[model samples]
Target: MSSETDSSLPTVAVFGLGIIGSRCADQLLNQGYHVKTWNRTPKERADSESDPISAAEGADYLAFYLKDGIALREVFSSIQNQLKPSQTVLNHSTVDLETTKWLAEQCEEIGCSFLDAPFTGSKVAAGQGALVYYVGGDSEVLESARQVLEITSKEIKPLGPVGSATVVKIATNLISASTVQALAEALAITNAYGIQPEVLTESVASNASGSVLASMKLPTMAIGDYDTHFSLENMLKDSRFALQLAGDAGLETPGIQATSAAMEAQCKKGHAHLDFSALFKAYDTA
Candidate 1:
């Protein structure tokens, strides 16, 4: 299960030089690993090496930070052959369970180890190397990737086999979406009564009902700054996936459906790039 072929630490090739991939690659480089990176958008190449196939050449770990399953599928065409049989591919994208499982099988076909290691936290955490990772794969494979994953994650929880990590990630998104919706509704109620947002936020922070969400987002709400940490569009996407999972399980999830609708409304209003706290804007404008 060891991805490294030699006595030395393995070289890593990261595909996608976006906020997440770039941060991961930088962390690997800082830890003294030879890191190679590539991005679909040529302009995204930030002085790091480029070319997906070239990056995979002789790499012991091939990590993907793709946006979704479709992007991952597309990228495979270019680098599938370059991936060595014993090398591991860590997929950090929040893709569906079925797709994750299929990707693992695909990697197995080529003699590569595949781990679904979807993450929570945003660009802020990525840059700070404080993201929380939920890993799913063979336990031995996970142990092999532990050192590298530890560099960029504050917590790395092994959830089970391939695709289980994605389930946990989607479940986490459900809670986050619901929390943001509840916070927005609560703030709107207070706003309707002419209560100061700062006072309400302070009281909530000091009360039993307060949460990490309130502590992290209240400052932005007080200043009416809805810049991105996690975007409404991304939240909506996650919500949809969560709801789909709920449906597959024959369970009810009206809250997720409601939150997904709200996010869609916000996105349609051209706030897609804004933080999920922008959900407040939908209520504020309504």
Candidate 2:
């Protein structure tokens, strides 16, 4: 039915209107794709549907950008029997590996193709349509979804079948959490020694250890500006998923383990909803 609007573009139904989903939905609409959107709490948007089933009806691509595996599963179950074999489902949330595989299996049971397509990039990237997707699915399924995917991504890196992207995403988040924790410790040490926070930030930027993440996060952390590009709680959830993967392989990841502990402390102190760089707040009292 959506093809009636534009024969070339498939109708896309986007679930979740959190930071990334909301922006991506806007991008799809702006690009002339017929988009149906739904958020659990309901948002005042013209494209928003009253229920998940309504949003998904007759959709060619059903994209989920939910908070966690729990939310994803709940919504998918509500619409599972209604799904047609012609539809392709994309999971863009970074959730546990078990959940990722579960989603794939469920889709297969209904004869619908599924893609484990969690992504990287935060609120700003979503707004700019520059998110990078780490996709895991059959190449043909990917090609079928490419045009809609490209509406919100700068690049699509296809890794392999069904669950690879989720693994890569969790591993990458472990590094990010550890890196921010290290940056927080370094900033606290330098500031205690009569060194300016900005100086340390500049030094890191010029050092071999510098990164795009540091450049963007360091200055903000220095001033206690944790403005939620990605929430501390979301990063904490991903870190735990990483630990689970490592533990299953009989490996110890002390760095992310310690960082997860720090994030938990910050979350207890009521900073969970802030940007993940709020890890620095753990040292604000020290």
Candidate 3:
């Protein structure tokens, strides 16, 4: 285990060096924090010499952009013995509430703090340090992570304790998925009616019902550019997370269910690695 520094600057350990994780680490570095990072695969680590346990050793804050619940559990197990009392763990992964709460309880048992701080916005937002954070944790811990959160996020909104951030993240995913499906349907409808996609998008985007998603995706749809900023696989995972949350709450989410089906169809067509906006292809080709 690494030793904590006496310097006034905060020390952080970041796991999962994916697009978002890399951006967060970069932001922390810019803010003059000593950020140690790790990834599941050696090549995925920003610096291969840094192992997960060693990266987390002696860190004041442990941050993660985990791939899934299983990955988070694996990391927690690996570092369980090394974590110090009062050390804060910020989970930025979009996962189920049950899992988040379970992890928080586990951390609490070890005398550490856990915060569910899932994010909104994509690589672009992360690169610009303009992402939004939905924070769920004790008020004091949330406040303590505020400076570090501000380094990588433009806004951090507390939604209550423990599992609340996951709840909000699920809602956000539902809205995003719904928006993509809506855009796909609208573009397909306009094309069938012989109305140009550019024209329809322009008119709708200026109206109340138009969303940031519609505008952002319109240009790409017009030219059929569906490159990956956020992959369909990840979107599908989030949709599943949302559906699972609804099931746990004993609520029905018909729209999310429909969106999940559409996304699965796109995935079946082998577009899982493509941008989520590629869902448009399903409707466009029909």
Candidate 4:
């Protein structure tokens, strides 16, 4: 909220340099934190290298925006011994509640406190430093890391214990994936009848049917401008995870089932690397 961040800014080591991670490093640097980055894949920046051990050694905060819990475990397990107990490990991956709890267990075993802090927003939100983080950890630990996190978040919701953030993340993503599926199908059906999608999208925007996601993706979907934002592969994995979560809770989730099936169909068609919005191509755009 303040232009001035807390005085206790720590040197942050960012692991994983994907769309979200790179944008995080940029914002951290913008906030004047001493930022060093390491990707599993090497980069040429002076502060970035391929070595995780060296990167983990010097920083007071280890921030990860990795693909999943397995990747998080492998990277940290390799260097967990070297990490100081005082350092905080921030996991920004959108994973299941169990995975989040399990990773937190591992971090605790190695004497480092862990924060399961998954996020929302795409590359655009990340680059603009407007990402929203759903953090599941102690209030004291959250404030301890708040200065470093503020570089990239509009809100840092401390949603109770270690698995809470991930639970929220998966639920929110289920909504997003289901919306994308419905919106894309509507566009496809309209096109099949030779009606312009522009009319449908415009009308939807004015009525109760409009959504933040539809507005963002609909224009691009109409023109087939499917530059990668969130990929189809990630969307499928997220949808399946949500459905699995619902099943685990002894609840039936028919909507998530349909959502997962649509995503699987899209991924099977070899559009996995493209944006999740590329569900537009999964339709009968033929």
Candidate 5:
């Protein structure tokens, strides 16, 4: 579906102008959507409102790209009364399953449609309109929001129902966190044994165990380039959410548990804002 809104496009209120949100909003605007934006911390942009309510009013779609469940609930509460049945609320933030359900309920009560649409893809992908959305909600509602979503995503995957997308997002993050940790450990062990980091990187690339995560992270980790594509703190938060999901199902997630612990330690060392690949910093002998 290709579109250019000009002034006729449905107005979309974008909350939370973080790494992904900021880029998405810009893309939406460039694509001809009437985009209103708000961030908890004020951002200096003409389209950004000073508060959530101001941003949401008169908008046909209220899209959240917030930090976590707490921020999502807080902003949602402030604007719930303003929501009408005619408006569609799309949550693009990766939040806990509990919050995903709660948001659905809140929207239900307000008689407005909602989509549990947490997405995968970080700064670069978002900027390039390549994020893949894991959508879980009413099929009709998804159709209504599809254009706005398509503006930011290369793929719009409908998983099941509300809360399912959140679970999948958290579950995938667990794999990503654990993979980086494994890469870090492998690099450390190889370096300790007098083998170069690049050798292990190459070996992993050809090995069945190799993945896109390994390819993207290993090169940067080798050079200690922890520039933030996705932050360690955010990954840590998602890992804990993954643990919660496992615990609820009476499952033992020892691997993610250990990776979560490592992330926690790294957060304490004040590396929370760095790229999640900074997990390698744990083995940084230099």
Candidate 6:
């Protein structure tokens, strides 16, 4: 098992080196922390091994940006027995509230502090060390980790106790999906009339219906190609996550339900791995 080699600098063990996880590991390294990186597929990056338990064995903080609840659960279950009281865990995955709260309870039993710290901004923001974190945990834990997390974030907001950050992440993604889909519908209607998208972009920019989501997606929609910042698959999961949360609260969210359906339809059409902004192409009447 790997352990902190240097006592002066903090040691961070990172698992699941996908886009967000990889960038966060780099940011921690840049901040002068001893970074131990691991991934299921060891060949994806140099110096990263496949043994997650060993990577986290003696780390001060263990961070993860895992794929989903099942994957995150498996990793945690594997290491839960080995976790030391001195370690803290920061989960950056976008999972449901029940699972996150369950993790909080489980980790607490093993004497490891846990934080649900899902985030916003894209791979672009990650590359630039400017992602925004939505955190949920004990207040003192959030305060202690704020500076370390800031190594990859422009903002770190504590929403409430465990599971709150996961809810906020789902809510924000639902809004974002609706915003992008609304812009797609508007552009498709304009295209039906032979109106240029440049004209539509200008109109939205000047109108009360304007939004950052629409503005950011305009250029991608105009070019008929997406850059894959956030995958349609991930966004679709967020849409479903919103519906599940609403159901748990006994609320009927018709708009979000419809939005989730649209997202599934787009994903079913093989756009699953593209930038979710490509949902605009679902409305390309031309």
lDDT of 3 by residue, 67-163 (tens): 7788898888888888888699999988777779889888988999889999998888999889999988898998888988998999999998788
Model 5 deviation from the true structure expressed as Cα RMSD, one decimal place: 1.8
- What does the lDDT come to for candidate 5? 0.92
lDDT of 5 by residue, 87-143 (tens): 999998889999999999999999999999999999999999899999999999998
lDDT of each: 0.82, 0.92, 0.84, 0.83, 0.92, 0.84
In model 2, which runs have C-alpha deviations exceeding 4 angstroms?
1-7
Candidate 5: residue 34 lDDT (0-100): 88
Using all chains and alpha carbons, the TM-scores for the candidates as numbered come to 0.91, 0.97, 0.93, 0.93, 0.97, 0.93
Best-first order by lDDT: 5, 2, 3, 6, 4, 1
True-structure RMSD for candidate 1: 3.7
The number of clashing residue pairs in model 4 is 0
- Residue 6 lDDT (model 1): 37
Give candidate 5 regions above 4 Å deviation. 1-5
Query: Which scores better on lDDT, 4 or 5?
Result: 5
Candidate 2 lDDT over 143-198, as tens digits, reads 98898899899999999988899999999999899999889899889988989988
Tens-digit lDDT string for candidate 4 (174-193) = 98988988898898888889
Model 2: what TM-score?
0.97
lDDT of 1 by residue, 1-286 (tens): 1222333677888888776888877777766777778788774444355677877888788888887777888887677866678788999988777778778888988988888999987888888888898988889988989988887899998888887889999999899889888888888888889999888889999999798888787667657788787778878888888988999999999989998999999899999888898988876653
Candidate 6 on 1-286: residue-level lDDT in tens? 2232345777888888777889888777767778888888774554475688888877888888887787889888888888987899999989888789888988889888889999998888998889999999999988878777888899999899888899999999999988888888888888889999999998998899887777789867977878788888888888888999999899999987887788788888888888888778777644
